[model samples]
Target chain A: MNVRRNLAGVLALCAVAMIFLPLLLTFYLSVFDETLIVFPPHGYTLRWYARIWPEFGAALRTSFFAALAAVAVSLLIGVPAGIGLARYRFRGRDAVATMLLAPLTVPGIAIGLGIFVLAVLIEEHTEWAISGSLALMVAAHVLITTPWVVRLCLASLANHDAAAEEAAASLGARPLAVLWRVTLPAMRSGIVAGGLFAFIVSFENLEMTLFLTAPGMTTLPIAVLQYLQYHIDPLVAAIAVAQVVFVGGALMLLDRHVKLAQVVA
Target chain B: MVEEEHPARLKSVSKRTAATGFLGPATLVVTVMLAAPLLLLLRFSLNRFDIKELMIETVTAENYLRFFTDPFYLGVLRTTVLVAVTSTVLCLLFGLPLAYRLARSQSRWKSLCMLAIVLPLFVGSTVRMVGWMILFAHGGMLDSAVRWVNGVGLEVMYTPFAVVAGIVSINLPYVVLTIQSAIETIDIRIEEAAQSLGAPPGRQFWLVVWPLALPGTAIAGILCFILAMNAYATPYLLGGPRFQMMAPLLYWEFSTNNNWPFASALALILMSTTLVLTACSNLLIPRRYRA
Candidate 1:
């Protein structure tokens, strides 16, 4: 029994280490005073973090807007879709669910390539050029994020009591009023979860963004990649550390509102 | 009851129209934006690349023919599949024990471990790859640690080993989480019953728990395989210019070489292979146990 317990403990520790060691190392690397990332820094400094604005400021803003816009657009489409799927008994409902979730299975690179090809073809044929457009990037991100919003909202609405909405309606409440007061409130947690999922997925996404991003309008991850290709500096580490800190804060908020286990399941 | 009046108030045709109103926008966006582009990819792959014109014009099988005929491309496909398979199996081996532990334990530490698993998903794969690059680089932390123990340092960057390590690290959390969820569904009473019948714990797991969790574990394996196979940032960053994966190769064809037909062909191959494999696996698993 002791042996088995010890083995379990060891495995658990290894899993935790695998997940966190890289993040800790990245944070540690960011503070190194040396320009190049090396073990055992001579001294700690915040110069790299300070310098990130000049190096990656525009890309950061672009990524931020792109993620935020993607979240908003996905919610606009995905919330209604989720409600329809969860509440309505419609023809081809299964097909709609599959279509919404199908993007999850396709390779991101393939999606990016496909979108790029279509954009290029559109440019070839029409006056509408979507190659470097922020709208284009958000659209691509919506393709990636809307699935999460739909799935989570659907899950949230799965066990919802429609009787309450019915009772409200029978009490002379209009459909819009019931939706605004009761249904939306019931699915609030799911919408929040979905929005968080959508934001993170859009923000961290690289493969699809790789194809959509134009020269001056690059996202932060793309900028980091380009930077990495040229220089292996603590500045990139600083950017990474910044992202980790932001995500870590968001995660703490998520933990407070939702059970991580339930979310994953 | 108010039901008769409610049905009279909300006609079936109106209900259908309302459903369409709610669902139509998403369906249109997906059809126009996502599905249409894929169909276009299929068309692009069939056409021949025109260098001077800078786009595919004539229909030809040359791109795919070149892919299948060339040993170099074949070697790349092999390497990509091998790395994906190896890392997936590794994730399974490493993740299962941790997942089992998380599922069975009621300790506060379990919650912490679960948090650790989900946290990495929020962090960009690019940053994680960069972390791996630093750790495995010559004179990096891993080298220093190894040297302290063995009196010799190691250079791991730009190697398949580095790529596989990155893939495993990126995927392990997901594999563990899925398996843990699967294990959560198995009734604890069955394990107790097995124990009461004088079965050893390991025997009970193999006889009772393993069969129930097998489908989930298999699904986890498939997910890991697909992610590892389609990996872009990790392979591009850690694998360096020397190593070639299917994704980076496709990116190069489209981005650098300006060969849209070939790139489309490559994407079709990669995407189709993934779809077929997933389909086959789903078929292999019985409908009842499949997730």
Candidate 2:
């Protein structure tokens, strides 16, 4: 029994190490003075972190605003759709849900290529140009992120009892008032979690953005990838460390309120 | 979720309208942006690629026929399938134990483990692949560490092994989470009952827990397989230019060669293969365990 328990402990530790050690290495490498990302650096320095902003500032701005817009749009579309799906049973309800979630099953590269084709066709025939517009990028991000919001909101709403809202309605509250005071409040945690999921997924996305981004306006991932293609440097590691820290912090904040395991499930 | 509907009230009209109103905006976005584009891809795939005009208005099956008849494309398909399957199997092998541990434990460590597993996802794949490059590069961390212990160096970067490793690492969290959910659904008493019958812990897991978790495992397997098949950055960065996966190949054809017809045909083939595999997994899993 002791031996088995020991084995389990070792296995757990190994799993944790495998997941985290690469990240720790990245963090260590970010501080190296060397330009080529070599190990056992001659000396440690903070130069890479200082240089990242000047190098990747625009990409950071683009990724931030695009992700923010995607989150807002996702919530606008997802919350209402989630509430409807949760509250009402209509004919072909399953089909509607499946269609909304279809993006998850499709490969990202295919979606990228398909959307590119659509943009090209529209550009060829129409006077209105939208091939690399921010609007198109946000729309594509919404396509990828909205499903997550819907799923999370649905999970949240399913756990919420509808009796409270009905009580509010019966107490002379208008339908809008009931939704504002009762329904939306109940779905608050779900919406927040869903919004966070949307933001992170959009920010990290590359496959969808690759085909949609213009030459000058690219997201952070694409910028980093392009940089890596030409040069292997600690500056990229600095950028990576920044991304990991931000995401890790947000996730930690999220875990304080909701069990992420339950959220994912 | 069904509230008691008051049949005599005028509120029913609003409720009836609300469903369509709520669904319309999202449906419009998805249809216009996603479904319509995929349909366009299908049309392009059926058309012929004209060298001078980019794409001619001719319908032909030559693209797909060429894909099947050419040994190069056939080999790429085979390599793609092999890498995906290998990485998925490796992910399952490594992830299942951790997933089971996480599911059964009530310790605070569970949350920490969850954070560790998921935090990597938010960090861009570009970053993680870069990290892998540093770790596996010649005279880099992995090489230096191995040399320190055994007086020998290791070389894995720019190889299929490195590509497979990267795929397994990225997909591990998803596989573990899915399987963890499956195992969590199993009643603890079922395993305890086996324990009471003189079965060892390992035996209990094999005989009782494994059978119950099989459905979730299968679903997780399907997800891992799909993710591995579609992976682009990892194969491109880690596998180097010599490596050819369908996604990167499709990207090359469209971006570099400007072969729209061929790229569309490849995209369709990848999409259809994933769809069929997913359908098969759902169809084959027993109804009770179907995800």
Candidate 3:
């Protein structure tokens, strides 16, 4: 017992230090007066934080709106699709499930590049360039995140009683009422958890955002990347700290209600 | 999805259908927005297309042939595999023990440990990679730490070491989380039974705990493999442009050179290799479980 306990305590401490110390160090780096990231700062200032306000503001706006739209679109499609998959004994269920989850397995490069060149071809055909447009970005995010909502909502639905749905239908409740009253209420936790997961996923997303972002349309991650390419500055550090606050808060909240392992896996 | 159901259970199936209206809007959205574009990319890969000429529409296998034949491209593939495998293996080595540790702890501490384990994931990979860049840089935190202990410095930043370190740090959360769940899945009673069979602590673990944990480890390894192989930004930033992966090469070919053909070809190659590796994993792993 003693050996096991100590091993666990030490490892937990290490994991904590692994994540937090660096975050704290980055936070410290942000406030330093010196532009360079070297330790033992000469003075402290909030100038870098101010710099992010104007420079990265538009990128933040784009990211927020993109993620918002993505969440909206995924919920619209995913919640229903989730119900059908989880509740119905349909043929080709396995194949459909695999198709839904396929994007997760494929390397993102294939998806992004494939989508990129495809968008261009559409532009030629339809005379509209959707590539790197906000709508395009939202569409990409939805493709990626919908499975999250579906998988989670399915899990929620699977746990509930089907008899209730049937009973409600027999009572002359419109199918919409049954879903709004019986189904959604039952899956609310999962829906919220799934939605939150989707939101966070959308929030911190970058890989897809990379190929998708044009010059005028950039997300926070892309902006940081572009800035870091030219110069390594504390403004990034300032932004990193701000983002961590939100992430840290969410992690604590999720860890409270549901096991992250269950939610994530 | 809107089937006729009871009013109390929330039926308005028909009206609900009418409410949402467009049944396959998202599907249409993905097909037009996602699928159509990718198909065009496949076409572009075959055609001789460039920034200046746009498309000559001449079909050619030259792009595919060149990528396969070129040593530069071949070397990038090799490095990508090496980085992916080494980093994934290392994460498993560290994560198995760490996850096992997390699983056996008290409930109060378990939640904290879980949060701590996953905290690294929440930070954007871009920011996380930057931290790693600084940490591994000469006279950086890692450098200073090594120097303080050994009276000499370690050169890691910008090397494969730094790249893999960044990879492991970024991916450590997933591995540990997987291993933790794997450990959780194995009922503790099985290990107890092994103890009653007069097994030593080592046997109790290797024979009982190890076997039970394999599936989770398999999953953990696969995830680490995917992240390592598909990883773009970390290597782009930390690995530098000098060290390349399959993903970034596809990126460079498409974005920098404006060679969508080569990029598409690279994308296909990447997909093929990934599918092959994944198929191999699926075959080998579950078979091992049965055996």
TM-scores for all predictions: 0.90, 0.90, 0.84
lDDT of 3 by residue, A91-122 (tens): 55576666665666667778877766667767
RMSD of model 2, in Å? 3.4
Model 3, residue B42: C-alpha shift (Å): 2.2
On DockQ, the leading prediction is 2
For model 2, the superposed segments whose C-alpha errors exceed 4 Å read A1-14, A170-172, A253-265, B1-13, B109-112, B148-152, B179-219
- Cα deviation of A169 in candidate 1 (Å)? 4.4
lDDT for model 2, please. Answer: 0.84
Candidate 2 C-alpha lDDT tens digits along B238-290? 89888899988988899988889999999999889888867876776668655
Instruction: Estimate, for each residue in A1-265, the C-alpha lDDT of model 1 and write its tens digit.
Output: 6687677577767766776777788888888888776777789999888888998899999989999999999999999999999989977999988898888788888989999888887898999987889989999999989988997788788869789989999999988999899988898877887887798789888877889998899998888888888888778878878876777777767777776655655
Residue pairs in collision within model 2: none
Which consecutive 10 residues in model 1 chain B have the weakest lDDT in total? B108-117
lDDT of 3 at A35: 66
Per-residue error at B227 for model 3, in Å?
2.2
Candidate 1: regions farther than 4 A off: A1-8, A161-173, A254-265, B1-10, B100-115, B179-219, B283-288
Q: Candidate 2 chain A — worst ten consecutive residues by lDDT sum?
A: A11-20
The 10-residue segment of model 1 chain A with minimum total lDDT is A256-265
Give the distance in Å from residue B24's predicted Cα in candidate 1 to where it truly belongs: 2.0
CAPRI grade of model 2: medium
Report the CAPRI category for model 3: acceptable
lDDT of 3 at A115: 69
